[model samples]
Structures are given as structure tokens and as C-alpha cells.
Target: MSHDRRRALARHDKDGADRDSGGDSGPDRVEERFLRPFAVAAGDPDGSGPGPGPETLDLLTLVVAARTPGRSEWLRPEREAILRHALRARTVVELAAEVNLPVGQVRAIAGRMIEDGSLQRCGPSRPLARKDILHAVLVGLRSL
Candidate 1:
């Protein structure tokens, strides 16, 4: 990870620690600690520069373990956590929720992992709802 990224993560950790110790509680603190980095990374809060744009991966996109192992030594602690969590099939949102990191940050990290073969993007495959299946069966029975 870059120096700036490391700093941001460190700050995030500190913010979490502070919140745990009852140092700060409110939306302002949450926004400062969580959303500021994204705004800064996007260049401007006003959407002036290149911005985050549409290149960011979808939160619901599924991720799976790659055929090859990643070089853990080359990864940051945060990225290592992400890779470990991805040992099984998980979505980008799932990974973020597991690690308590912002979805955008997780997406960026997962994108790098995909590029370097540490992870693979998988197609979304949620199971069908049981209620929906039963409803369809009932409709079919009525038609019969």
C-alpha cells in the first residue's frame, strides 16, 4: 500500500479506537473518519476532478479465491485481511462488512488483487427465494 493509504488506514484504526473508548460519537465524526479519504481520493468533494466515477466495481459483485496464492509479504495488513476473508466465495460488500472498511476502499483493494491474480471476480449467484418458488408452484398447479 502507498504511504497515504497506510496513513488513512492508521487514522481509521485510531478513529475506531477512539469511538470504542467513548471519545467521539456522531455523524460528523463518522463522516470525518470514514468519508473524508474517499472525497480526497476522488480529488474533490464537488466532483471537480476525475472523481471516483463509474470505474469502481459493483458492491454486489462476487469474489472468489484465485488458483494461485498471493505473496503475503507484499500485501498490507488490511489487504491481507481481505485476502484471508476471500478464501471462500464472498461479495465485495461482504468483504467490506467483514473487515469494517468502507466498500469503496475494499473494492479498490479487491480490484488490485484481481489484477495480480490473488482473487478472481465471480458472477453473482444468489439462491432463489423459497417463497417465490412456492408461489410459482402454486401458479402452475392452478393452471393445471
Candidate 2:
């Protein structure tokens, strides 16, 4: 709020002058650094400064655009194999062993699949029990 500082700023603004006005003034130095092209450009690539590359943000936006709610998409190979063994095996532990993955990883993937409507428990939530309807149908067919 000094009279000199206020007058200088008013002069610069009224003249529509670039902040880099031909002098080593304090405001000019500050504006030179802050108004540099790289400072203001979003998604500066080359890792030369802050923020992500344009390509990275663009790819993320594309993925978000592609996602749909409610119905789950078809599985990747790893997800399919994990779901298969989870349904066939007696326990999460058993499924993990069958798939040769850590139990925690198996459980996390299975939980996501179920939440996303891609997989469901065939019977009661407990493992080791054969699905009753499937078992009875198989038994009666064997008699035939």
C-alpha cells in the first residue's frame, strides 16, 4: 500500500504493459518466474516439471469414459482363472492353492468380482459344500 508501489502498479496496468517492462523491478522479476510458459501450461511432459503428461491424463480420461455401471465386463485371463478356481474349490484357501496365489489376493479379486456382478456364490456362503441343486440334478441323472 506504499504510494510508490501503488502508482507503479497502476501505471503498468493502465498501459497494458507486459510485466517484464524493461527494468529489473521486483514485480517484473516475480512475474517473469510465475508467468513462464511451463509454469502455466497444464500437463507438462518430459518430466521437466510438476503435473502429469498430457498423454497420461488423456488415457485416464478415456478409460473413465469407457467404464459402465451395473453390469460387469468379461474377465481377463487372470480374473477368469481366479473365478473358476474360486467356484470349483472348497475354500478361499483351496482356491488360492489351486491358482498358486496368495490367499489375500484371491479373496480380494473374488470380492470385487462378486461386487461387480461378475461372480456369485453357487450355494450358501460357506465353502466345501457342493451346490445342493447341482448335486441333486447330477445324482438323478446318474440314475438315468
Candidate 3:
């Protein structure tokens, strides 16, 4: 395994031990659960490479969170937290920082939320040029 992967696995194991020994509290336990799969995937004990890369989610993309629509439930509390945080307009980076998760993971989670329609991208509604604004002003003056 790569050095970084080994380090991550060690940290994960340490965190797991802490949980088992009751050294960690609520949020820490939640974080550990969220990170465990990433650690295992990184470790790749079978000598396989990392899993397929997640789709790119732009850090600047603005997302607005909403309820999952119907009875569909979130599988992970961490993801639900992410959705909750995104209830207001927030960039992927901001959500990541707020939730203390890696940006890539945040991106993946946001992408999934978007796919499930629990989040909506608040993209630029329109791009108005200075020329367009000036032209509109001139047209209004002519009409008046």
C-alpha cells in the first residue's frame, strides 16, 4: 500500500479502537463511520487499486437542500447532515468545511443528493452584458 493509504488505515484503526474503548463521543463516532469505507477502499488489502473515481463536483457549485421529496430515507446520518447544512445556499467547499469532511467526499455526497433531487443547483440564472444593459436603457429612453 502507498504510504498515505497506510497512514489513513492506521488512523482509522486507531479511531475504531477509540470507539470500541469508549474514548470517542458522538460526533467523532459519526465521523469514524463516515470515514471507515474510505479507509478500507484506500487500503485495498487485495492489492487492487482504488475504486472508481467519483464524478467531479465543482467546489463553487451552489446547492440548495430540500427534503428527500417522499418517503425515501437517507442511509447515512452524515449525508443527512450534509443535506441539512445545505438547506441554505452553500458551496461544496463550504459544506465540506462545515461538516469537517474532505472536499472530494463532500462533492460526491452533493452529487448524489443532486441526483436524488434532494438538492438543486442554483446556477446563474442569466448572464447580462454591459452592452445589453446600456442598449436596454437606450431603448427605454427612445420609447419614452
Candidate 4:
């Protein structure tokens, strides 16, 4: 390292513990984006990869938290992350991006969440009017 940079870093370090940037000198930025499927660690029901299959979640399936719980102590870390992102109503793919997991993993976890009543499916992920699909279809093409 250059002498000037080393001395400047040392001075900053001595200023206070609160000012330490943990080796970084700039605002936070996402330096990497990679899948960490191991954290989820699910295999096929018949013992294969965790890749999506029988769970059959369409890429566009909309997911929304069925209801906000006061405390969700029973959910796994992956499930919890999924639910947190679902509160805003996004598709399985979108939720995958939000949680930094693969789309297949998110779909699998989301399907299980739906079955357990932690999440509710309302058809397409887009935020069309009527809120949940339970509301009447007021969009055009009813005449078609």
C-alpha cells in the first residue's frame, strides 16, 4: 500500500470507532450478486437436486402474505425472508430477486408457505386494481 494511503487510513482509525468503515471508504454498494442455494438446502422428494419440479409454481404466480403475524417464530429463515418480501405482492421470480435466492428455490419455499397458510396466491403477480383477485374483474375485455 502507498505510504500516504496507509497513514490516512491509520488517522481515520484513530479518530473514533464509530468512523471505521471496515476497510471500505465509500457508500455501500452491492459488489456481488450470486445464488446461495446451500443455505436453503432442499432436495427432491425422491432425492435429487433442489431444482423446481412437482411444486409447479408458475414463474408469474403472484404471492402475497395471507396475513401479518404478531410473531413468526415457526418459520425458517428462508420462509421468513419470503414472507417479508411478499407483503408488497410480487411474483415468485421477483421474490427470488428480493431474497437473493434462485427462482426455483423461492418457488419451492413459496409453495410450501402457501400450503401452510403463511402466504396467499392471487393469480398473476402484477398489481392490477381490485386488490386481490377475490375482487370483481373491472378491467377491460369483459365484453370480449
How do the residues 1-144 of candidate 1 rate in per-residue lDDT, one tens digit apiece?
476875675587866445544545634667765442453232112233443343356888888867534556243566667777888889899999997788887876677667657778886466568898799899999999
Residue 116 in model 4: lDDT: 60
Q: What lDDT is reached at residue 124 by model 3? A: 57
Supply candidate 1's per-residue lDDT for 124: 41
The list of candidate 2 runs beyond 4 A from truth reads: 1-75, 87-89, 122-144
Residue 40 miss distance in model 1 (angstroms): 12
In model 2, what lDDT does residue 141 have?
100
lDDT of 3 by residue, 1-144 (tens): 476875675587755445544654835667656542454232123423444554457888888887643334334555667777887889889998998887776787676667657778886567579899799899999999
Ranking by lDDT: 1, 3, 4, 2
How much is the lDDT of residue 134 in candidate 1?
Answer: 91
TM-score of 1: 0.47
TM-scores for every predicted model: 0.47, 0.32, 0.47, 0.48
Better of 1 and 2 by TM-score: 1
